[model samples]
Target chain A: MEITPTRVNFEFNPHVPIIMDSGIFKAIKSGGSSREQAIKSMYEDNKFRTQLSKYIAQNQGNEEDTKDIFQEALIILDKNLRNGKVDEDQNINAYLFKTCKLLWLNSLRKNNKIQLIDFEENPEELVTNEDLETFREEGKYKSLQKALTKLNDRCREILVLWSQSYSMKEIMKKLDLKSEAMARKSKHQCLLKLMQIIKSDPNGWED
Target chain B: MNESFYTELLEIKAQGKLNPEQEALLTSLIPQGSDLSSELKAYHLAKQAIEIDISNELKFKFNEWDQKKKSRLFRVDFKTISIAASLFLFLSVCSILWHSNQHFSNRRIVNDHLHKFNTEIRGVNSGPETLSDRIGKLRDGLEQNPTLVIQETQALLKLSVTGVQKDAIEWTLALAYLENNQNEKALTLLKSINANPDHSYQKHSKAVLDKLNSNWRVFLF
Candidate 1:
């Protein structure tokens, strides 16, 4: 069955100036814009999804990679691709290409595919913002998500019960603890196991 | 001593029961400051996530590792591929030079025709003409002058802030011609209002571009 998508989204990378359609812009700027509005506005406007997805897929990436790329691009664009510092106009494609190229190039540098020396640069690239709140949020969320995935099944269950604000008495019956003391003991042990896993993988979390 | 101590610490944290001394003692045992309760909170969350799914950690929608290995395979021939690419680039350069040679003669022939057009048009259009016609005359002036024409064309394509010379694009082109003593071409370009408004050329350059399109030796050159 064919599901006809009823919206325009995804344009090219923002470097090439591939001119945006005016109609979509109107929908994006529709009245009463809040956080909820912007999320929905994604469907009604923001026509850059297909191009971005295709680029990732062509590079042998998947939808998950596509999502990561999209999110990272969003954060970086908000951080860097603004203020008319670049030759940005209404051309979403060109703007996307420029931003996307920077992303791909930076990723390449991280992966050792490209050099990091002064090939090209702007002063704004360095001092855009001191706090990368969006990136940090994603990092914290993803770390928690990943650590949860790495738990043993029993440890996993106990953690879940404890997280739901389950009391020691409730957990004692559910996890078959001998007493509240046992459930408490198991919960702490389970939590320590998770912390150990996280500590092993700590990249930015370390002081 | 350590086993029961660690166990009691876990139990004390688990039941949400802690004597002040026990809590203080637990804080000393854990190396990451006294955030034992917070650590347990985060750990509990991760455990819940695992209970939901293990594929969350170990699974990918695509054969990512396999694809990465394939890309790695290509790295084996990096030197050979670079050499091959360099050779291909050399051959492509040779072909372009061969092609440009063919285009050069065509450009020269076109320049000759443009020169003829310059001389003929100068004879016509005596007085105040339409705005569009003046623009046309200016284009004709710049075209007759090779230096001015090249500079103007370069500016147009340079993709810089200075490229858009408001209305003086033709005048700049005209200046380029005047500098090269292509007075006839400069005369045509000056006739255009758009050409006159370009800013890079000096007043002298503008005067030279606007000087009567005559056949006398441009001794200034």
Candidate 2:
């Protein structure tokens, strides 16, 4: 099945430059309702999807890869544009494709795949402050997700409940434990177990 | 340092229940310029990951796109009436013709732009040789000394910025990637040039991209 943007909630007027003059970039940068609108707009844009699909296909990446690449690229572009890294006269569409290409290519390189199309090299170490932060968060998230997956169901539940701010008394009541001490011990033990798992995995996180 | 005290500190931190006295103690215990306790940091990270579900959202969007594509395929394949199919075929033919025309025009424009760009850049007076000079040299050495060129290009590219110099360096780096058999990176760079009409070396870059893509098609198909 080929991916296409078949559903558009509103007409996208190409004549109107939405990247700069409009508040879409600002909204994306601010993140919230405006960001959601920008994401939806990007998802609905036929050209944007096509560019992603084409590049992904050409690079031996799948549709899922396209989705991640597209989102990350948009985030970087949003941040860069806000910081004036992208010139005002530059075409936003071009910037999108360019950034997507670099990210996807970098992913391929990281995976140790030699297969790449030589369009041009990404000079100037394209990683941004936002990208570094995102990478750190991604690493931490992956490590944590892995550790959580390895835990017993009860331990996972206990830790999750504690993280969500349940007091020992509340947790004991909710989980039908014997006492507050029991809930506290269980939560503490669960945290220890999670930490152990994360620490054991050398590749779990990177600064 | 008491290990149990550290453990208790982490436990309270994870639960967001650290009192002012406990927080002060934690601040005192933790070495300056060091991160928060490792266990506590891990716990918090995992907890945030679970609560925010940022990774999960990525998966959700991918699934949505996949399902939409499948449904579209099913609809077009099984439910399209003969009249609609005929119209579709007609539109397809029209699209192909129009696309071919645009391709030829784009090629001409790219060639013209490259000629002008080359002329303009060549007119810039030569300055003292530096890292940019090495990038230029690597560009020339890409076919001759691919490994060394790639090494130099990567080093130089890391230090370059966005401008005519960086653009030229990127162009060379792309060539280095191609020479080093990293076709994916090369293709990506070429695609950027092809897509951006206002790129510094837009014409020459796109021309190279077109050639490479054509070769790729032959190689793949």
For each candidate, what is chain B's TM-score?
0.21, 0.40
* Segments in model 1 whose C-alpha atoms lie over 4 Å from true places: A1-48, A51-103, A110-151, A157-186, A194-207, B1-221
Best by TM-score: 2
For A131-160, candidate 2 gives per-residue lDDT tens digits of 423434566666667777888978877765
**Best model per lDDT:** 2
lDDT score at residue B176, model 2, on the 0-100 scale:
61
Query: What TM-score would each prediction reach against the true structure?
Result: 0.24, 0.35
Tens digits of lDDT, candidate 1, A1-207: 333322222224445322344333332333122312332333222346566667756654567766565555443333233211223334544544445545554455445543444444556542233322233356655776776667777788776555434567878888787998778778767767776776666742443
Model 2 CA deviation exceeding 4 Å by range:
A1-37, A52-68, A71-98, A108-143, A150-207, B1-53, B72-221
lDDT for A89 in candidate 2 is 56
Per-candidate iRMS values, in order, are: 9.8, 6.3
